[model samples]
Target: MLAATEKALEAEMNRLKLAVKTLQGEDKSEEIYIGSYLLARLEELGVTSMFGVPGDFNLGFLDLVEDHPTIDWVGNCNELNASYAADGYARVKQGSVGVLLTTFGVGELSAMNGMAGAFSEMVPMVHIAGVPSLRQQATKPMLHHTLGDGRFDAYIKAAEQFTYSQAILTNTVSAGAEIDRVLSDCVIKGRPVYITLPTDLAYAKISSDRLKIPLPRHPSPNNADVESFVIDEIVKQIAEADGDVVVIADACAIRHDAIDELKDLLYKTGYPVYCAPMGKSAIDETYERYGGIYVGSISRPEIKEKVESAKLILSIGSLKSDFNSGNFTYSIPTTRTIELHSHWTNIKYAEFPNIGMKQLLPKLTARLEGGKAKALQLEVPRFDAHVPQETDDIISQAWFWPRMSKFFEPKDVVIAETGTSSFGILDVPLPKDSVFLSQILWGSIGWTVGSTLGAALAAKDCNLNRTILFVGDGSLQLTVQELSTMLRKGLKPIIFVLNNSGYTIERFLHGKERKYNDIVNWKWTGLLEVLGDLDGTLSKSYTVNNKSELTELLENPKFAAAEVLQLVEVMMPKHDAPRALQVQAELSGKTNQYAL
Candidate 1:
């Protein structure tokens, strides 16, 4: 009996010894740190670069990112720009997530607006914040970055409103699971997520076992009954249609990673493919069945007549924001419409739940493999930028856009700002493999400055063509500091600053002549030198006031082929606006008049 009791006592002592060893951090040699694990998961998801501004709290986490071989840390000028950069990164690379690293309270709060915009537009981004240690939180010490009220949850509570999932890793034991869960939420939902990792927890040891398993990013849900019913209803609508069946693809088609399936569906059915303004460049525009862009009231006459008169409209991944739908001018009837979304499908008035685009698209494409092609009545207008133009005229809004058409090449990632830049580019057809990113739904000015940095990085990763940015002066002023970051990174993009003087979109909205729509003028071309430390090696900026100068710059072979950062400020009339913008603004004004 004594021998057995002694054996049990020895076992208890050994267990206690191990417990003490773990407490003293002696047994962590075989374990992986949470920082390394988080990066590994991100690398597994193909994150080649992370964008953020470094701060005292997040320096430790940044160290791990720096040490990682697969991912590079892109330092931004500020947290807001970093968040916008992440949004742009996600938009360029389909099915890949963007990560933004920042510090606690001040850092996270400053990035809220940019992340909120991502949430509104369904871009998946991870906003990882380095916060005060759990020990500091428990002691309730007043922190420099905190609000000093001792309640540490205020920033997180604010984030909860914008983020799809918010996780605080106070306990290292649950860090791996928590990180996986939050990132999964971001990817699966296509929205930004907030993850607060305490400064102490960055180096915390977690089991390496979880790293062996892949985190589920895309969760496919299949309700056989619902899908069957949904597919049957969709096929029947097309069959009973009197006119040609047309498709209206939108931004979510790219967000939901359904481009390939969409291509297959269009190919098999021989349906004419048209993109909503948000979904511009979602498909290969060079394809034979490619139709023009459809923005309802703002659509070109031929395109509008074809779409409105369609017998059945297959709207895929459609997010019908007012701007996307041409100020709510869509006239397609519910009885003749079928909508396919990432989460659900609506056939006319009936919506079937639990049917996701990623899963249903493939099945639907297979069903339509031998389906009949629609006989389109009208042909989309052919686009050509080489049209005749006067030699010595001042560049106007009418002349600038078509002139830009010849400037674009295949594989270019075009980013347009919220004002004149965004609306003007709507009329220009993108080249093959090109992308169009704009904050039409969110309408945040100055977003393109930071997004240009991200889109350039992503474009380099994919070996795509140039990164082009179009922003008005007022919008550029809001986030122009990011130019320094772009110069520092040695990325080359053609940045066109519409020198229309001020907030052209806002002027179009309400204040055409109000002081609120005007802004202080700066030497726009001199900015590149100022931001680039006056070094010609970093970038070249120019200001063009007339048509000849702009055309001359476009025709310069050296400028066209140069790998240096190029900035061109195109001067135009202050009162000029795109036709679409003018019409939409007028309609919106009348709509608001009823409220007044």
Candidate 2:
């Protein structure tokens, strides 16, 4: 009996000693720091760079990111720009989630608008915020970044409205699981997620077992019977129409990582495929059957006619926002439409839940008879820049967009800002494999400048062609400070600042010449030097006031090569706007019941 008691006591002592060692973080064989684990998971997900502004709460966590071997920390000028940059990165780097790091309270709150835009547009993003320690929260001490009213949950509550999933890491045991769950939601749903990493938990030790296991990247598999029924119904619809079907691809098709499947479907079916404005580069434009953009009433005459007259419409991953659909002017009835979504399918009036397109598309493609669509006699309008013959020096909106379109190259990433830039680029066709990004649904004015930085970085990662940005002078002023961040990172992007004096889109909407539409003018070309290119070695700037000067610059081989950061201040009439914008603004004005 005495010997057995002694043995039991020794076993208890050993257990206590091991517990103490874990508490002191000395046992390193099976455990890893939470911060390092998070970074590892991100690296596995193809996050080569993270965008954010550093702060006191996140400083320690930033230290881990700095020590990381692969992931580079890209410090933005502010949190909002950081969020926008992440959005741009996600758009260019399909199948990869953009990671954003920010501090608690003020920092995270500032990034809310950008993340909200991502949620609205279905971009996959992970927003990681470093907050105060758990002990500090328990004591309820008033911190500098907090609201000072001691309502610690207020900020996170605001995030819930915009984020698809959220988590606060208070316990070390469940931190890894929580992270995996939230990030999985972001990827599967293609929306932003919020995570709060308390300062104390940054170094908390957790089991490293989960690191070896891969996170679930794909959505839950659909029910087999339901999926088959959905596909059968779709095929029946197409057969009933005698394959007089037209396919319209939209933003979610790209966001949900269905581009390859979509391409296979389009190629096999040989149907005339068109894209919405947000889905500009969803299909390879070089294909013979690839039609131009279809923006409802604003669509080019030939495209609008071909699409609306179809006996059946296969709308893939469509998000018919106001601007995308020309102010809700889509004339196609639901009975004539078959919609494929990430999580569900709608065949005419019948809705089938739990049937995701990712799983159903491949099966559907296999079942369809190839090249049946070739029998349909249709003439897809030839989409070209079509620069008009001009007699004068001024570069009108109509002249500039088509002229600029000629400068794009295959594999380029083009980012157009809201207002004139977004609407103008719609009429021009990009090169094969090019990527186009715009905030048509969100309509944030100054988004392109910051997004350009992220897109250029992503383009470099993907080994794509040049990154181009178009923004008006008025919109540029809001987020122009991000230019310095771009210069600091040595990113090479072609930035075209449309030097139209004020808010041209706003002027067209409610105030033709009102003071609210006016803004302070700055020397646009001198911005490169002011932003940090002191000796002009890192960047080149130009001001083109006439058609010939701009034409010469566009034709220059060196300029087209994108060897260095370049900015062109293309002067235009302040009152001028794209035809699409004029029509959209008028529609918007009437909808708002505003007197112009």
Candidate 3:
């Protein structure tokens, strides 16, 4: 207890010391360049690489990035892919915001789709754009990248709808402070922001004194009386229940950096913990008390029944999007749920405002440890389910997913596209410390390819085992060029191409046999040879049309433990879909959510 208190005191003292230094404007130094300052801040936040493409407007800033000591510039094929890569990096790195750079109007506009997804999913990032000089803005000159209408503020206006904060560095005097403000908000809100840096201002000198200031990393919640009463009432609520208590971990656990706190709470209370699809990797999946994932109609039978029939449900960081909640299919009423969020929490429809989960959860968890509970002893259901045989030449969905479960190792990062791959992974149990990456709420198909680039880099920095990606053939065709960039950086993520030959997810959504769902065939197994390096060295690629072939490859020691890039094209029937996907489609179709 003394050691823990001393650690807390030390952290508080360091925070105070930094705050005091910022207040005094300690010994202004002329040693900082604007671009250098940006890169330095990122490096301090544990960011090893910045993702973007080099354009003429942003080339000056790239020069500073190139000369930086620790930060590397990861140039992508285009702006949109760069944005996707940054989003993935932020997701895997945990507590660090993604950084993306682009040129003025054309580049920023093209990358808007990626930022929109970030906004919808609450991913943190800083999107910087290199615009024309301040002189050109004053003269209203028609720039090459602009619409020739001389409206300089047009793009930033569009960006405002998609970002939490937006700023244009028109003066060097305020550039440092403005940058700090925007970055502070990005980290605090866990949302993307937009900053337009002028071409000429990229080289301006700035004071580095502000670097001494530290952002408030932890929340200092208010309403002490409300907090005390709430926790007591929460305990009472649980004790009042007759049957069992459960915790539903959601995506914001990852967004708000509450994984440890949530885990501590569950462990202390000894309650069964189930994860939403968006929160798949947030909790310790290997935990003995872990129930499978729950998402309304699509959830596994055991999970759905356990969660819905529980005496009380405690949902932490809940976000129920169309895809996440199985199109509003959750059976638990608000009266039965105790929903805790970062800022506010509610119990049985009673609101407690001005309380932060980052600060409140630990108290609640500790309070439950020694306190008596009605349902102190509970048992989670054990499933001895069998994996069915394929009984055919092609690898079926059931056979492929469960087979890959044993292949996963600890500390690995797995990314699945927003199609059959994501739905198929719901049943497989991941290895300990493995991170799951997906954009389900946004439902972007090809986001995984670019995100894999960023995720692989992050995994390498943390010395994780592997960065694996599961993408369908149709989705891969959208942004497959990122594979070349991955090769350029020498990142070796295990790529699994679910080669069903068309938009299988879309077919389930609206078009079962529509011509719009079909795509042109590509030689998936020969991609490495086409995108070889200057030395003509190629990564390994394999095509598997039979179960035995895939079994042999997965069982091979050298293939399972890979050092370079490897791609496996797994063939299955075009109409094959995961059970979850089929259930979700039936629900949506019955409600006319998708076209007839």
Candidate 4:
């Protein structure tokens, strides 16, 4: 009896010990200031780094950042560059949130362009800004950095346009909950969120016991029944169609993690599947049966004929916008057209037969299982196969891309800048499941370099290798400061910069008459070396002025080992005018009376 009692006592003591350890592990008992608490919540959300310029209002938060080991504050030349860097980091991090901090008024305002890009691309990020104290709200005293009447109203308005949610931490009591709410929404929605941390609240103590970190709600498809029925009807129409069937995927398709199932449906139906420009990396780019970019430079006469003859078009996760559809030339008949969308919100050009993709994709995949649908077998006629090779010119962007394409495997990521490099890479074939990221909708420059760093870090965690960035000389100079962060994190990315001396795309649009299109050129390789901490051991520059030199450099194994190899002075004649540039110019001229 004594033995049994002793054993029970021992077991109870062991349980108590474990409970104590678990409580000790939490360490949530510390009474930290509100700003500190907010920073702690950011850490919990897996944001290991922050990029921004510190100002008077945010200096206290910056001090807190210095003390924290988990979160590293990355300083940039300006707020605009910092925002771009944070956006780049978000794209590369893969499920981890990007954080950007800025002071009130101009500092926060400068980040709007980059934040808007994140919103358009659906990259998750948290943008935090420092504002004046809440106590001075009623008096409306002259706050430093305020625009008019001591208010930062414009910043809030700009943030509303780009973020999924916004919060203003007015006092110590509201800081913890507000930070938790904004971060939670960003994770759940897969979009950017904004929060304003008042300067006066930074040092105010908050009770740790009262702070409750609530679990975020996952939004599910609400009208499942209607969505399913619509999908079934659309699939039935496609199954009955005669000529051919083609599926064009968009950004939302990639966001839903439905690419694999979409691929399976396409393969089963034997229909050719093509991706919009923004949706290039949504599926395995190297899939043997994959079709090329359908709406951009790769769009050929044969492909257009197939699209026109197709009795039914399945646009899964597409917006059917002007750019995605090649200026609405490939309009679908109401009886034969089907659209799948993530949100049921009203979409533009909704005249065609449409339904939410969230409901459509799953039902279509299921119904098409065991049902027979004829395969699309259209011959793609090569336009340039017969052209004689030119020997004297500098390396064409088109020629360089194919060579670089060979280096990319199924797991590699390609981030292209918004210029000649982006247009050049659109035609380069990718391996299956390889990702391609760019600022498509917002059309921002200097995005690719920073985004590549973030992507490399994310890829490293997944055991994926090789995050490549291709940027123009003009774009690289805009946000080159982020190279320090990449070096600090020990991220090795092969940055292939096309050393064009100007904004080639803008010059192409403006007919080379605009002197503003040209940029003061830099020796890119030397600049990168100067910025980062390399002991001169990194792979360096190979200036290729002609096609022969480029070919030789690509073949050399030594080129790969170099940490940052800037292919300097590669002259590409604004020869092949990108189709998108032409369209954009026409659209701009048509929409704006003054441009005419």
- 10 residues in a row with least lDDT, candidate 1: 1-10
TM-score, predicted candidate 1 vs. hidden true structure: 0.93
Tens-digit lDDT track of model 2 for 36-91 = 98998888889998999999999999999999999999999999999999999998
- TM-score, cand. 3 vs. native: 0.94
Off by over 4 Å in 1: 1-30, 373-392, 594-596
Model 4 per-residue lDDT tens digits across residues 185-298: 776567899998777888887756423433242333335466555655665575576535667777777654446557767666656666777787775655544666666323
List RMSD in Å for every model shown. 8.7, 8.4, 2.7, 8.4
Worst 10 residues of 2 by lDDT: 1-10
- Against the reference, the lDDT scores of all candidates come to 0.83, 0.87, 0.83, 0.66
Candidate 2 lands at a TM-score of 0.94
Clashing pairs in 3: none
| Residue 105 of model 3, lDDT score | 87
- Cα error, candidate 2, residue 71 (Å): 0.3
lDDT of 3 at 499: 89
